[model samples]
Target: MNEFSDKLLQWFDHSGRHDLPWQQQQTPYRVWVSEIMLQQTQVKTVIPYYQRFMERFPDLATLAQAEQEDVLAHWSGLGYYARGRNLHKAAQIIQQQHHGVFPTEFDEVVALPGIGRSTAGAILSMALKQRFVILDGNVKRVLSRFLAVAGWPGNKRIENHLWQVAEDFTPHERFDDYTQAIMDLGATLCTRSKPNCQACPVQANCMAFKLNRVKEFPFSKPKKVKPIKQAKLLMLINNQQQVWLEQRPQKGIWGGLWSLPQFETDEALVAALNPSVKTHSEAVSSLVKWKAFRHTFSHYHLDIEPVKLVQEAPADWQGQWHTFTQAESLGLPAPVKLLLSQLESEYVKNG
Candidate 1:
């Protein structure tokens, strides 16, 4: 075996995960589903969702045939709804255009909507062992520090340089093992805040280790403060124990997910009432103010106020109640889930 290959393999045997859920049944379809879900999300959180999603749509044909709502609902709690949307789109394309098979070619994978070079590389290498290099967040941090790469990595020139480094380090033998090992190194040892340097396998040869600047090596970029956005969320509950929910529009933040009615402000909600809402006096019955919540997104923060409402509303509104026990049926975003948990606790306390 080659030097990097031997070291990587040895490091992997002792340290790498041989037990991830997707790893247990390492097929292309299973691997692809897990990889897409893993983007900008952590493994700790992805496992349960991965298990649930796969149970819902086990194969490429099932995913391709699923309705957009079913797909979105399966991806409800996971942020970055676009990933689910594009996964559905890509599945359809593969089923129709490519005959229900995930394309092995790197170029073909990247051409799909919402897939970039790194994600394409991940699918190609991990699923097919075709030897493409991935440069995800964990990999980027690991590489930048190991090589002591300077400049913001998000820059194109720097990114390309890192890509070359990635390509250089990848081993030809045991393609899948090596692909996962590098990511594991970053996730387990070379962490962002505080790394387990004593336990790090590559410490002996790591440039940043020699310099004692591992954290600084992956230099920071200037960041604009994430703008703060506010919304008023209503938790409209009837005595029947059903809550009102609105399906978000199919784009932008939390697109195609179920959420409580979110308005810019309480006043705007009352002023520009829906014609359907205006027709029925019963719909305006009673508003019970729960504690307001503030949720922060990547680019913006949402100051949310979750209010509880009682009384009969127009039955024509396109929503239904799934008593608290069946709340899982409605795919909810994180903030809505948070609100529900709060309400549930309140319900239990009152009981």
Candidate 2:
């Protein structure tokens, strides 16, 4: 092992996070689940979800056998619906192709639905004690600053260079601890903003720190204005206090998740519900336009316009009507959940 790795490992033995839920058992299945959950999400946020997920589906077989809705329901508020969908799909593949065992081969692991190169490495190194290099977000920050790498790590040219650095620093022995140590360093000490350089183990040789430009090494993504997309959420209600919900298509945003019917405009919604607008206008009881809000995504901004329609006659809607309690338990987009909750609260307050 090199001096850099040695120092980091020593510090890790003393201060690194060793008691995370997944670390307790440290199986391939556990590590796989944890890695997926940690993608684009913080450790604190992933813990409760991870624990609840593990409790519900503790092993590969259980997860593989679970319904997609059940899996998504557990991951409802976690966001990034595709990850949950992929996790479930990957589990089924493992059951069918590998006899319900989490694959250990590097290529085989990476072939799974949600498992990427870095995630595959993490599952193997941390769970199987294999020597594999991982360059996750945290690792990228730690390495970019340590080596003073230029250009955003997302760029292919820069990413390849960072991958080499990660491979070089990785040790053959105690690969498990080394893998966890480096990630912990980035997450705890080498944070993106307000890093604790004094407590950093390798800060003495850190080029960015020496140059007093820790924030400049790992260049941020080139700024671009996120496009704004507008949509209307139709909350059709019946007398029994049930609301209309549709299962989103199996691909694209909020894939395979239950959500309110989305329409491009009020006219389009009216055309679908009532072909003759004049007759429909006379029969409708109450139509409410709630306050609009923005849900920002990585590539665009979603301007959500929620409309609550309390109609007496149950029109032949494309989706089914579910009670507020039933809808609460399904896999709903964060915005949809919030709107439903607000509507439900208002309904109870007046009565």
Candidate 3:
């Protein structure tokens, strides 16, 4: 075994975790779900999502047969909705074409909707024990520091170099444990802000530690300034206290979800939902009060006004009560959910 491998193995045997929930079974399905959910998310946060997701759809067949709404409900708080959609899509493909079994080949795993090379490598190595190398964020950090590699690690050239480093250090005998150890070390000890240099087993060989430049090797790329956008939210409340809600289209921003009827401005709002919308009751003749606010997203900012529609729904416009409890159950997008929650607290506080 290599020096890196030997030291890392010893460290793992003494301190590594073997009791993570997903480690219990290590089935291809279980590992696949966990790895996908863990992308750009922490292990602690992924646990509840992984458990709840497995509880809802324990097997490939179950996930394949689930409706989009039901799957979205299970993935409600998981933030990245596209991952859930891709998981369902991949499951369906496996169920129909492969007889409910994921293919073991590296290329086949990568061919799945959202499973890229590193994810495929992880599945093949960890779950199937096939020879492959994964290059996740933790792995990138670990390799970059150990080799003192320069340039942004995410760049294609640097990524290719780190992949070689991963392959070179990976123990052919204890590949799985080795793979998990390096990742665990980077995640737990060699963290982003303040890596515990003393706790790292490979510190002697780590070029970054030797040069005292642990923070300098893995440089980040320049960030683009996020842009801003605007929207208007219409809250059409009635005497029975029912509010108007609409189902977003199946593709695009907040797709395949239920949310309050929203638009761009007064002109657009009227053109869409409130075109000649009349009063809710004689007591509420017209809108005498309205509210406005703004929200921000990853790629852009959103300027929004949650306009209270004192007017009732027309006889032709189809809508329902959509209670708070039911809202929790529905797949409301994050922004809509936030507003609904704020409005609920305000409703209770005012009453």
Candidate 4:
């Protein structure tokens, strides 16, 4: 092994995380799932989700056979709905095209939905002991700081440079250990905030450390104000105490998940509730208004204002009514779940 890999392996023997759920099995399917979950999410948050997911869909065949709604239900509050959608689609492809086996070829793996070059590299290296180089967020941070690579790593030029650096350091032997070690080093000592540089094994040659610019390396993305969008969610409840829900479109925000009926403004929502606009006119009354809040995504913020309406029977509403308990079991967004939980609590108290 080269000096870098040698030192990293030595440190990993003592400090690296060896007990992650995916590491115990190290199958391509398990590693692939864990890697996808780890994308833009922290390890602590991923552990339970990984365990629960594995229990629900143990293998490629099982996942491929599952309904998209059930699959999204498993990933309900995890966020990034597109990842869940892509993961389901990829499983079907693997089952039908690859005969239910995870693809082994690099190109084949990369072509799978949601599996990018880095994610494919990670899966291959860990599961098959391939010597593919990886450049996930943690790896990028570790490398960018170690080499003091200037410019945000998101920049194509900077990312490509880092990829080359990754190739240079990757050793032929013990690559799996090296892969996990580098990722561990970043996740632990070389963290995003208040990095534990003193304990880092590769600190001797880390350019940022030597230059006293550790904080400056792995430059942040250029800042732009995230656009704010507003919407109203109608929580129409009937005497049976079931709230009306509509399935979001197959694409876009909260896609494929069940959510409250949404409109651009209160006027639109009011018009929809009017008896004249109904397929069947039913008596309705305004109930208590819930506190409004905002759900922020990576590129934008959705300001959600929820209005609760009670009706004798919601014959006019176009969607189905689900009790709060039933709605909890469906694939609802995180904020939507919170709102429903609050409503459930109120219902129980009122009873």
Task: Give the Cα lDDT of each candidate.
Answer: 0.80, 0.90, 0.81, 0.89
TM-scores of the models, in the order given: 0.90, 0.96, 0.89, 0.95
Ranking by lDDT: 2, 4, 3, 1
Q: Where in model 2 is the C-alpha error above 4 Å?
A: 278-286, 312-315
| Candidate 1 clash pair list | none
lDDT of 1 by residue, 235-346 (tens): 7777876777777787788877778777786655553445435444444444466676678887888888776766455556666665676676666798888788878777
Over 1-351, each residue of candidate 2 has an lDDT whose tens digit, in order, gives: 998999999999999999999899789999999999999899999999999999999999999999999999999999998899999999999999999988889999999998899999999999988888899999999999998898999999999999999999998889889999998998999999989999998988999999999979699989989999999898888888889899999888998888988888776666667775665554334457888899988789999889888763336555788999999889999999999899899889987
Candidate 3 residue pairs in clash (backbone atoms < 3 Å) = none
Task: Compute the lDDT for candidate 4.
Answer: 0.89
Model 3 agreement with the true structure over 1-351: per-residue lDDT tens digits: 899989999999989878888898889999999999988789998899789889989888899999988888887776777788889999999998788998998878899998998899888989999978888999999889888888898788888888888889888988888878887997898899989999889999999999999988688876878787777777777665556677777677677777787666566666554445553343233433345566666678787767676566666764556767777887777777877787678677978
Q: Which predicted model would earn the best lDDT?
A: 2
Q: Candidate 3 — which residues are off by over 4 angstroms?
A: 276-296, 303-305, 313-321
Instruction: Write the residue-wise lDDT of candidate 4 on 25-78 in tens digits.
Output: 779999999999999789999899889999999999999999999999989889
Candidate 3 structure, TM-score to reference: 0.89
Which is the winner by lDDT between candidate 1 and candidate 2?
A: 2
Error of 4 at 221 (Å): 0.8
Tell me model 3's lDDT, rounded to 2 decimals: 0.81
